[model samples]
Target: MKRNEGSFEFVVGLNRYWLKWFGLWPHCDRFSSHRLFVTLLMAISLLIPMTACLFESNDFADHIEILSKLIPIIMVTIKLFILRVKRNYLRLLVEEVARDWKNFGQLELYEKDVMMRYAKLGRLINIICIVFLFLVQLGRLDMRFEQSEEIGYSAYQALWYDLSPGTARFFIILILRSRKPFNITAGKFYIMSMSSFMNILKTSGAYLSVLKAIK
Candidate 1:
C-alpha cells in the first residue's frame, strides 16, 4: 500500500488540514529558522494572557483556565529548544535511515518482525494522539464559549475587563487554541525511543534467562 505522507485529511478534513495549514503538522520536516521565529513570537505573545491571569484574576478557577491554555505554548517552546539543539543529530539520523532502506534484507527474521510490529504500533499511537488532540481542542472551545457566556452577563461582568466589544477574551482564546502542544514529530520520537529502550531491556532479560538455563 502507498503511504500518504503529506495528507492530513483526518476527521472530515478539519483537524489535520487546519493544523497543517497553520504549520503545526509534520513538525520534523517543517522546521526552519523563520518558522522558529514565528513560533517564538507567538509564545512570547502568550505572556500577555499569562500575566493577566496571574495578577489580574483573584479567582483560582480563572488561574487554572489561563494556565491550561498557556501550557501548550510553554511545551512548544521547550520542544523548539530541543529540536534546535539536536538538529544536526536528527538530520544525520534521517539521512542514514533513508540511505539504509535497501539493506532491510540483511536483518534476521525475528528482527524484521519486531521492526514491523513496532512500525504498526507507532502508526497506531500517532493516530490516537491526533484524535486526542482534536478532542482536547474541541473541549477548549467549549470551555471558552462557556466563559464568554458568563462574561456577557451583568453578574460576572466584573470578573473580566470590559474591553469594548470583548476582543481581548476572543484573542486570548484564539491564541490558546492555535498554540496547541501536539507536535507529531517530537511525540513520535519520544514514543519510538521509549519503545526501543523497553525492547532492549526485554532482550537483555531473555539473554540472561538463556544463560541461567545453560548453567
Candidate 2:
C-alpha cells in the first residue's frame, strides 16, 4: 500500500463507502467482514427469489422451476468470483487510482476538468449499480476510457505546431499514449468493453429463453 492510499479519502470521502462495503478498496485484509457480508448477501439473493418456487402449484410439470431466480444469482456469483480471485490486481488498480488522485493538482486545468467529468460519469454508473445489479457500471467505465481518443484529437488541434520543438514533443507523447486506449480487462481473457457487455447480455437472455422453453 502506498503512503497516500488513505489520502484520497479527503478528496473522495463518502463516495468510497460503497466501494469499501464491497471490499473493492485497495486495503487488504486477513479476515474481512465485508467478505462475510458478501457471502451472506449472495446466499440471501440465491435463496430469497426461490421463495416464489414455494408458491408454484404441484400440477405444473416443472413445479420447481426456480431457474428464473437462479440465473441472476449464478451470473452475479460468477462476476463476484472473478473479482475475488483477481483482488490483488484490483487492489493495485485502486492504489494507482488513489495515487492519481493524490497527484490531481499536478494536472492542467482542462485535463482536470476532463478527468472530473469522467469521474462523475463513473460515479453515476456506480450509483446505478447499487439501484440494480453491478454489470452496467463496469461497461460504462470501459466505454468512458475509450474517450481517450478525443483527448488525442484535441491535443492535435491545440496548435502545437506553432510551439517550440520541446513543448511540441510533449504533445506528441500525449497523443501517442492516447492512441493506445486505456482499458480494463478480466485477467488476460476479456477486454471489458460495451460490446463485450452487449454480448454477455444477449447470451444471458438467450439462455434464459431456452431454459424457459424447456420448462
Candidate 3:
C-alpha cells in the first residue's frame, strides 16, 4: 500500500520491506519466487562455508575462527526459519500493530501527534538495536578472523557444539577429542572480544610510563 511519509503505515510498510528482504514475510507460499531467491542465497552463503569449515577445522582456534565468521549467518538464518515457520503468528502481530495505529488515527490531531512522537521514538530505538545487530552480523560476511563476533560466537559455538547438530557433532567429536581449554587459550583466556582491548590501548601510555619508571 502506498502511504504518505507521515502515515502510520509508512513505518509498518518499511518493516514489511525488511521482513520480506529477510525471507520471513509477505509471501509465505511454498513456491514464492522471493522466498526461493533468498533460500538459494542462504544455502549458498550459509551452508557452503559451514561445511568447508567443519572439514577443515583441525583445532579449537580453527573452530573458533569459523564460528566467529559463520555464527551470525547461522543465527540470522535460524531466526528467519523460526519466524517463517510461525508466519501465522507473525502476521497476527503485524496486524495488531496496524490495528493499534488505526485506533490512534481516530484521536484528535494533538493527541495523534503525541502518539506518533512516541511511536517514532520507539522506531528509532528499534533501528539502534538493528544497527548493533547488523554490526554483530557483519562479522559473518568475512572469512578472516573478525573480532566483531568472537565473544558472542563462542557462546553460540558452545551451544551449537553441545547440541551437536548434524555434521558438527562428528566434526567436533573428532577435533576436540582430547583438547583442553588452555591449549586454545591465549594467556589462559579466549581472545574473544576487541572492545576491551581498545580500552587497554587507550591507557597504554600510562602503563608504558609505569614500566619505564620500574626499569
Candidate 4:
C-alpha cells in the first residue's frame, strides 16, 4: 500500500476503532479549537471531584478515594500533552513505516511481523485497561448504590449532599474524564510504534541508529 493509504488505515481504521468503542476518541478534526474544548472539559471534570474532596469531604477515606481517582486523570493529562507536542513526528513515523514496508525488499516480512505484533499487543493492553477501569467504576457505583439505600438517599442527592454514596459523582466525572484514558491509550500505542520502528531500523543495519546516538 502507498504511504498515505497505510497511514490512514492504521490511524483511522485500526487505532481509532477501539478508541471510539471505548468512547475515548479525541475527535480529531481540522481545527485545534475542538481539541482545546475537549481538553478544557477534561480539566474541569478532574477539578470538580478534587474540589469537592478538598472543601466538602471531611473524612480521610474520602480524600483517599478522590486521590485514587485523580491518579488516572493525571496520567491521562500528561499523555495528552505528550501527544499534542509529538503529533507531527507521529504522522511522519507512520508514513515512514509505510514507505519502509513497501520499498524494503528483504526486511519487509520482518517489518510487517514486528509492527503487527506490537500493534496487537498495544491494542490488547488498551482493551484490558479499559475493561479494568470499567469494572472499577462499576464497583464504585455498586458501593454507592448500597450506601444510598442505607442512607435513604437518591443517587443525585448522594452526590449533591456529600453523602456516603457521593462517589456516584464518578459517573459524570468519568464521562467527562474520558479524554484521559483515550489519550493514554493513544500515547502508549504511539510509543510502542516508535520503539518497534527503531528496533527494526537497528536490526536492518540502517544509519537511523545515529538519531538514537544524539538522544
Looking at model 2, report the run of 10 residues with the lowest lDDT sum.
Answer: 1-10
C-alpha positional error of residue 138 in candidate 3 after TM-score superposition, expressed in Å: 7.9
Of 2 and 4, the candidate ahead on lDDT is 2
Pairs clashing within candidate 3: none
Q: In candidate 1, how many Å is residue 110 off? A: 2.4
| Regions of model 3 farther than 4 Å from truth | 1-5, 27-33, 40-45, 108-114, 129-215
Candidate 1 accuracy as lDDT = 0.57
Ranked by lDDT from best down, the candidates are: 2, 3, 4, 1
Clash pairs for candidate 4: none
Q: Whole-model Cα lDDT per candidate?
A: 0.57, 0.70, 0.62, 0.58
- Cα distance off (Å), candidate 3, residue 159: 42
For residues 98-200, what per-residue lDDT tens digits would candidate 1 score against the true structure? 4344344666878756755665665677778877876675555555545645543433334345665575677566545545533223355542233444676
TM-score preference between candidates 1 and 3, better one: 1
State the lDDT of candidate 2 residue by residue for 97-175, as single tens digits.
8778777777798977876787777767767766455566665676578686688999999999999999999998999
Q: State the lDDT at 57 in candidate 4.
A: 80
lDDT of 3 by residue, 43-102 (tens): 567768686987887998888867865776677667766776788898888777666676
Cα lDDT of model 4 by residue, 103-170, tens digit: 53445677757766775676677768776776665556555544544443232344544534466566
- Angstrom error at residue 40, model 2: 6.3
Model 2 TM-score (2 dp):
0.44
Candidate 2: list runs displaced more than 4 Å: 1-7, 10-16, 22-24, 37-65, 132-215
Against the true structure, candidate 4 has what lDDT? 0.58
